[model samples]
Target: MTENPYLSVFTLTKYIKRKFEADPYLRNVFVKGELSNVKIHPSGHIYFTLKDDKSRIQSAMFRSAANSLKFKPEEGMNVLITGDVNVFESSGQYQLYVQSMQPDGVGALYLAFEQLKKALAKEGLFDERWKQRLPSLPRRIGVITAQSGAAIRDICSTIQRRYPLAEICLFPAIVQGPQAAPSIVKAISSAESYGSVDVLIIGRGGGSIEDLWAFNEEIVARAIFSCRIPIISAVGHETDTTIADFVADMRAPTPTAAAELAVPSREELFERILDRKRSIYRSFSHQIKHERKRLTTTQQSYPLQFPERLYRPFTEKMANLDDRLLRNKNDITANRKHNHERLDRMLSYYSPLQRIKEESRNMDLLVERMTRSIQSDMCKNQDNFNSIIRMLRALNPLDVMERGFSIVYKEGNVVNSVNSLKVGSTVQVRLPDGTVEADIKSIKMKDKEEDSNEQ
Candidate 1:
């Protein structure tokens, strides 16, 4: 057998590079680490080393790619990079060229929430002044959350146990998934349409940050911020904080806590009812005592019946009353007769029928004047109409054409002045009979001798 030739080190390295490129698994890989050494080239290339406690790897991102980054990549910052592994053709070394990057710890979603919170805070959405105060005892309350979620059940049970009199209207929606954001916004808007709802509880069962992302979505946040009714944001565990909680009128760590915030305690309300009953009873008892005293005084001062005891005095008073009554009647009859006579004199002096006749005469005179003015205006309008008709007839183009005059048109346009009639220009002459196309043979703009003779 012939002796085999060994390959050089460069050739061996090139073979290894080919093998790395051929591996499908190297096409896409995700890395998590803290940035250690970072250098930016003048040409917009970013070179960095990502290291954790034990190991490290080199990473590079071109300026074109770095420009799309939302947050600056700095040293000591942990990050997650999605990119591919490839050999540098010049150096014969494998490295990661990142396509996109984000903060590593807490994942991209949590970082995004923080960024959005900062931005919305600048716009006053998270300001405490913009939030409304919740009523202590609302007549009706709206609860917008997942219908099947334990949060809803917990809130319902707690509300029933605490304050059963409060009316709770449930606006159900998806509390998770891509559809959750829009569904939450819709539920909030629909709750507003109920018009009489005093407070709204928007929340769901406690879970991971990912599970509660719907409450942090911008649409849901904005809807909560703009709600006319007060909102109680109850989401996740006690330590969990979301955008909804920050913008809501009140924040509750759990759904049961939110229910407690929305309504009053039944035992406390019953105590208050009892106090009111006692006050009313005292007020009625005082009134009854006052009336009973007044009745006793009246019964002791007055007589029930005195038939013969009052008869003698009454008879003497009757005789005097009869004489006075007769005198008063006579005086009344005379005064009535005198008043009747005065009324008759007043009727004769100022006769309503004669006044009506005089008013009728004045009305006829006014009618006659109005009729004359209207007739005069009509005659003037008729004369103006006839004059307008005569003027229009004189200016009519057809009438001029019938009188043996013609109009010249060039290129479908009427030539109104002699300046438009250029020598050797073609034009159409319109007459009563028909139109005739002709060429200008001579130019006669104006004759000075004819003008002098006319002057």
Candidate 2:
């Protein structure tokens, strides 16, 4: 058999890929389509289908090209793509390897600006709460802009004219093109790290958006936001707005206006000082007049005109009290004298010797009567004592004991009944002359019927 002439699948695909690469028209192509089935891979590659009307083509943007894109691509978005058509060798399919992409009807930069504005706003970067208050009088003003531009000149001149006392420190930076954002950020950092400037004025003269894009950069915006010193943004004209403006502490329409905002006016300060001085002088004069009126009123008052009148009433009251005291003393003396004379006369009426003699006679009579009465009472008492002694002798227990009767004691107490004596207990028997100790051998109690019959 003859050798097979058919090409293998890999050989055919390789041939097609070479053909697509060789065609100059396919090498650089521009296509407009609506995105579909868009997917962004974790590796930063974008894969999608580009469709318009009835036709669709597979497309891809590798990480290198995707990184250059300013706005994100989404499904159903109308976009213009620029890339080369090539075969995906493994799949044997031709696809557009996108190099650049932009929204179909908008400038890429403007769209990027709007998209960034929305994102940062949603993150609260544009909130009023994050804005710092500008100093009323900044001592050192730092300026960040082109080294040799109308912006620097205008700002320096305006500051010098308005507030000569403020020291201007120029931080020269590039304010245009791609390098401007990094330059502005570096200048802001230098000013912050320097730690001496009270306020910063970052701005440039009026320009197109393309010329002023550095101020809109996210890095520059964040730098302004993170600065410790207060920042005032002045870019382009009155109508221009950028991310830096939104994040700065304040915004000015022009560089000159930024300078004017940074420091106070010397003339206005002088006027205020003069006004305060005048107010102080007027207040002092009014106070002096008020004090003089008070002094005059005091000098013309009744107490000052006739000073003795103030103490007259007190003096009269003192005199009256003294007179009452003297009268009370004299009256007390007369009463004391009268009492003394009466006591003396009564004492004279009873002489000590006569009183003693009379008392002695009365005492003798009383003694004699007491002696007779005591003797008569003693005789009567002697007769009554003899009768009681005889009666006691008849009733005495000892007398009865002498007559052949005895007393029995148990535990030192007299025993009156046989029931009080236990058979094993010891007791004492008392006679007229002696006590005899004995143990009870037995006890006998009288029968209740016999005792009752005897009673």
Give the per-residue lDDT digits (tens) of candidate 1, residues 1-455: 97778987788778888888898888888888999789988898899998889988888998888876645566798898888888876787788889999897656666778878988999999887898998988989899998887888999999999988888899999999889999999999999997899999999887888889888888899999989999999988789999999999999999999999999999988999999999999999999999999888766653524455647688989999999999999999999999999999999977999889999999999999999999999999999999999999999999988888998899999998889778899999898989999989998767889889999
What TM-score do all the candidates reach, one by one? 0.47, 0.64
Q: Which candidate leads the pack in TM-score?
A: 2
Q: How well does candidate 2 match the true structure in TM-score terms? A: 0.64
User: All candidates: CA RMSD in angstroms?
Assistant: 26.2, 9.2
Which residue runs does candidate 2 get wrong by more than 4 Å? 2-9, 36-43, 289-455
Tens digit of lDDT per residue, candidate 2, span 299-413?
A: 9999999999999999999999999999999999999999999999989989898899999999999999999999999999999999999999999988998889998888999
Clashes per candidate, residues 3 or more apart or on different chains: 1, 0
Q: Candidate 1: deviation at residue 166, Å?
A: 2.2
Candidate 1 global lDDT: 0.89
